[model samples]
Target: MGRGLPGSISGGVKRRGLPGAAKEERIVVLETENAALHLKLAEYQGLAGRSTSEVLQLYSAHGQQQKLQRTSVVTQLHGTVKRLKQDLKRLRSFVLELSKDFQRQSKTYLYQILTAVQGIQLENEAMQMFQIKAFDLEQSLQEVTERYEKEKQKRRALHNSLVELRGNIRVHCRIRPLLPFDAASGHSISEDRQRNFPEKVAYAADDETVLIKCSRPGHASINRTFQFERVYNALESQDIVFADVAPLLTSLLDGYNVCIMAYGQTGSGKTYTMLGPQLEENFAFSIEDESELGIIPRATQEVFRLLSEKPPGSYWVEVSVVEVYNNEIFDLLAKDNYGKVFGVKREVVTTREGKSDVPLLMHETVENAAEFLHLVNKGVQLRVRHPTLVHAHSSRSHLVVTLTINTIISGDNFGTSWEDEQTSQRLNKEVSCTFPQKMRENKSTSSSRASSPTQLEATEKLKKVKTRLQLVDLAGSECVGMSGVTGAALRETSYINRSLSALADVLGAIAEQRSHVPYRNSKLTHLLQDSLGGDAKLLVMLCISPDQKYLTESMQTLGFGTRARQVQRGQLKKKNFPVPSKAK
Candidate 1:
């Protein structure tokens, strides 16, 4: 099987080999198939790798595109955000401007409203003032018209009365008593003469008759006849003299000029009559209501009483007390040297009603009777005194006390129909006239005047009706022989006598209706000229004493009084006196 087997085997081998070869070939084919499969797988793998690469590339491209798109979107969003922010900024600016505009407009509107309100208020106030002023002016005009009409009627009536009444002289008589002294002791005594006097004594006012009765301790009465007003005692008669002059004092307060003088020999109670008796208490007792009444005290009391009765602003009084020693004027109220004297200078001033004299003197403000008495006492203390044969403590010089009073009279309120209607019409007119002016001016003044018609009428009436009063106390007319003066007192007595003589002459001239009366003869006469015959009511008090020692002097004093009574004072005619020029 080896050799044959070899050949056969070889053949078999060949066959087997063939088969094996075929198997081998089959195996090879399978291997090749497997290799091919492997190669395909590699290809597939390559293809998948390439596909995956392509896909990756595609995804990368897609991612790059997405990134670009996102970048673009973000840029666009940023631009949009910037645009929105700009728009917001612009809107905010617009809103702020609008708010500012609103605020400004609100302020302007408020200011305008406030200004308008103020203007309206001011206009209302002005209108109210204008209405008031108009009413006041109307009332004033009516009052003036009525007063003018009344004054015209009064003037006409006065003119007719003056023509009907003829000028005539009037005469009056006065008497005074003298001081008493004890014959054995040569001292003054206070005694009652009424019991020792005769039962019946003849005294006549027409003949200027006087009867004097004297009484002494353990002695019969002494009777004497004199042409004078008689007083048994100075103390007893002083009050009588004051009573007699009381009416004169009343007239002075009623707008009259009065002059009172004690004319007699020295120690005839001239000082006592003018100044009252000196009291041991407060020197003002005589003026305060002692047993004796003085001329100065009575006059002052009357003046004050009248002043009190009048309205507060209606009356003003000025007093001046002077002493004439040796033809020189000495101011009693002056506080300088006691013996200092000044000359009398008289000036005539023309007032609205008449002419008046301004005497050079010191004026004093005496508010009450006590104050007046105090001034009078001061004057008496300063007066020259000397012991005299006729009497003790006699006045050697003349004392003059003058009172000047200024007054205003208000028109009476008559409730007549005519007056009421006239007043109403005047008020209306005044209101009409003043309304426009008041509106144009400050409103305050217009409002005050326009409120009341009565106030306006009162103001207009106050412009008219001015009056003045004068009261004068002249020095006593004395006889130098009875006064027993020496040196300066003698000279003073001479001057006093001369002045008295001149006064008598003036009275005589006035009595005779002479064309020209010498009023400039002496200071006393010049000062008394208006009081003697002026528009003011006039009164003269002649104080005299009754005693046997002063019989001759009493007669002379009575003769002076008689002459003064013969001088008639004419009615005061309304005279337009010239006012002092501004240049003067």
Candidate 2:
């Protein structure tokens, strides 16, 4: 009903262009006239009754009501159209405001994007610059490393020059630190007012001097100062002690006998300085214990390193290990008929040239440092040792390790000549089962002469130049009461004390220029005869303890060192002649 009037009113307004009230009046007049016509037709058809006029009136009233409804519908449609036009105007303004906001946000977003792009470009350039600097730094590091290596080599050469200028004998004193065992008790000390426990009685006054402060009851206090080639304090490291001894290696290769001997009282660091301190009670060594290796291992490594710098195959090395136990010499490397190593009796005979030689000594040729140390470790395992009160494992024998370096040089290099007939007589007296390396050298000499003079000159010019490096670890002097030994150890200790006495006697005689220096009194002195009496470079490393308990023995050791330093041997005589000075 609502849609019908609005649609018809819209069409009527469009067609006739009528106002609202007038359109309603015209619709009512047409309905009244139609009702009257309907009444007349009913009468013509002979169906008119009294109620026909009444029905026509009712029909007119119904039509009049429909006109009012159509009028109200037109009014409502006009108001609705006006309200829709207003809402459309407001919506248009809102859309324009939203568009402006979007434009401002897009502008800000574009600026942020530009800034981020610029920052990324700067970062890329910085990365490239950093890479360039890293490469430059790497190159500089490599250059520094090369210079450091050169400096190390130069330092060794300069120090050896100073050693050569010093003299033939070098005596060094090392004062070890106070140990835990210096006190009578390990964990606690007694409340005695007489003796102070673990006190430092010796000190290094300077780099070359040691000062000892001695005070005895009812005796004038004695403050003694001794000068040595080098005095190392307890604060020094093993490397520092070896630094002074390293120059001797160069002298050994230069055709001179070099001897390094360690002498000290019992509980002193005699074995510790020669070999490293062994923590394990057994004879095994760990792989990571390189820093703990002592003078012997380091010297062996240095020898191989120096040889590596020389021409390949120009030199041969042989090693011999011997121990003096209870005044007898036993070869450590000597084997039985079944090819197993055992102690064998060896005799030290004085040659016609007055040099001592071990004829039946077992000589092992070593190709590298590791092999040499392995053989040494094997021999050390077989050494005789027993635990004492002061030391856990005290070495009861004196160890001697000799390294013989055979160098071949031109005959004209040194004035010494080996006549062909003389060398033959000496070679013929040798036993058949000699060292393989020595046999090879002797056989090479047999093929010396040739038809061509060039070949003969070549053969004769090659003379065997042999030099000896003797590393000796002498048995420590013992205090009978302190060592607390019984049956077997007491006897070994007696022998050790006597041999040390013989060494001191030889030094005393040499200092006084006696007609007869007693070298054959003990086996230790006899074996070291050439080094002590001949023109060999000798270094006696005196290891002492700062413990007040062993003060007497320490003083005796220091006194022995003083005597060794007083012996004025002549300048070193190398196989090759020394460079003549301007005076010559």
Candidate 3:
């Protein structure tokens, strides 16, 4: 192979040289191919090593992730165990508090139960004692009831006798203390008027008599004694004065139309006796002052007190206040939006039944004493008053405070039934005709008399059991020159004097039993015709000044009252109505 290599190398050198050259070239080509292959293999080996290193890194990362997950689970378990321990501690504390509160409440409830049981036992014992006492009281009440009935009957009989004793038209005299001006006679004097001129003209001799000494201007002095139902002195308390008049109010409740009239000269105590002393406008009268109250206030209190004693719904009372000024009837209780007097005139009309009524009169229903006094004050403020020489607050009108008391009584009662029957008899007598047979036959049915007993009974059934309590405060009569009143006030004085004179004439006519009563002469006389002529209980309170200067006016007042007392109104007939059986 060497020879061949050498010789061939020589021969081959030429041939092999070509082949060797070819071989060399092929080797070179092969070497180049091998070098290229080695380069490719090295590139592949580098890629494989890079891939192995990445796989190992991924395995290490997975191991580290597992360890971190184990650590997180262990930490979460530790926190959960800590929270459970805290909840256990709070639950133990709440249980301890609940046990303590339960025990405290149980003890309190036990004490309350024991106390209630004891109280029930005591109440049971007391109830048994009450039952025993009630039996004893029942027997005592029966005996007491029998005695009460007897006493009540005796009281009724005595009341009837007293009513007979007090005449229909009762006259009382009141002598006012001498005013300063009355004593002075409007003349200056060194000493006080009351002390200098001691009342020597008028004196109360006894409870029922008044002695008057009158010195005429040109005639001789005259001493006169006047008889009256009562004579109140200057020093008499208001309570004492009211005591005599209190009986009349009781008669009013007995269903009699009662009229109390105050008449006097100017500056006399007519207003003072009827109302109290003059006060500021709208000043309320209070029960706190018992001594200061006059007849109107005292009568109001007494009426309300008596009414309270009666059963509720037995009586309904309506009050109306009107003033007769200048022959015109004016409402004193009518008010405007501002509570001032409305100053509206009311008409005085005589009903077909011969009863005088102030049409459209304002009637106030009073519930209690305060409300009545309030209305009284309101009316007093609305009264027309003017200052005069004789009196500071001289009233210029005749104020009539009428209390219409409508009583609903049971007809089943004996007294009420008897009264109803008597009223029927009286009505029959009043309706008896004195006309001739021809006049009676010619009379129309509308004008015919209700002579039948059945018709009279029917009439009685329709009649309201109402009685009026009229408290009249007549404006005092004044001397035109002495009063120093001019203009409208002078005119008022004229009207007042005229009305008073007409009243005197009417009274004189009634006392003399004249056919013409003269009641229609003046508005005042006509308005008072019922009280003056009818069978109504009338009380004339004559107020006079105990002064020498007022002797003439005082004598006139006494004469008028004396005439009124002589008026023989047969008897005061109580208003009676037949009560329905259903009402009873």
- Please tell me which predicted candidate would have the highest TM-score against the true structure: 2
Candidate 3, after superposition: displacement of residue 194 in Å? Answer: 13
Question: So what's the TM-score on candidate 1?
Answer: 0.50
Error of 2 at 398 (Å): 0.7
Per-residue lDDT over 1-584 for candidate 2, one digit per residue giving the tens place of the 0 to 100 score? 33355456557765988887877677666556556666777676555554687679888888888888888899899889888888888888888888888888888888888888888889878887987888888888878878876885586456445545544457899998888667653222223312446777799997679998977666577698988878999988878888888878877765678899999987788777888776466754333577667888889998888766544444567777889999899988887889787878787878898888777678777767887777777677778888787777888999998887765544443533322344333333331222234444522111111235644554554556678889998999988776778799999999999999999999899878898999899998998898888557899999999876677788999999988877766556686622112111
> How many pairs of residues in model 1 come into backbone collision?
29
Instruction: State the lDDT of candidate 1 residue by residue for 240-272, as single tens digits.
Output: 656645654555543344555555555545556
Model 1 Cα shift for residue 35 (angstroms) = 99
lDDT at 517, model 3? 86
Quote the positional error of residue 486 for candidate 3 in Å.
Answer: 1.8
Error of 1 at 217 (Å): 26
Flag the better candidate by lDDT, 1 or 2: 2
TM-scores of the candidates are 0.50, 0.63, 0.60
Which runs in model 3 stand beyond 4 Å of their true positions?
Answer: 1-168, 187-199, 214-219, 281-288, 336-341, 410-463, 577-584
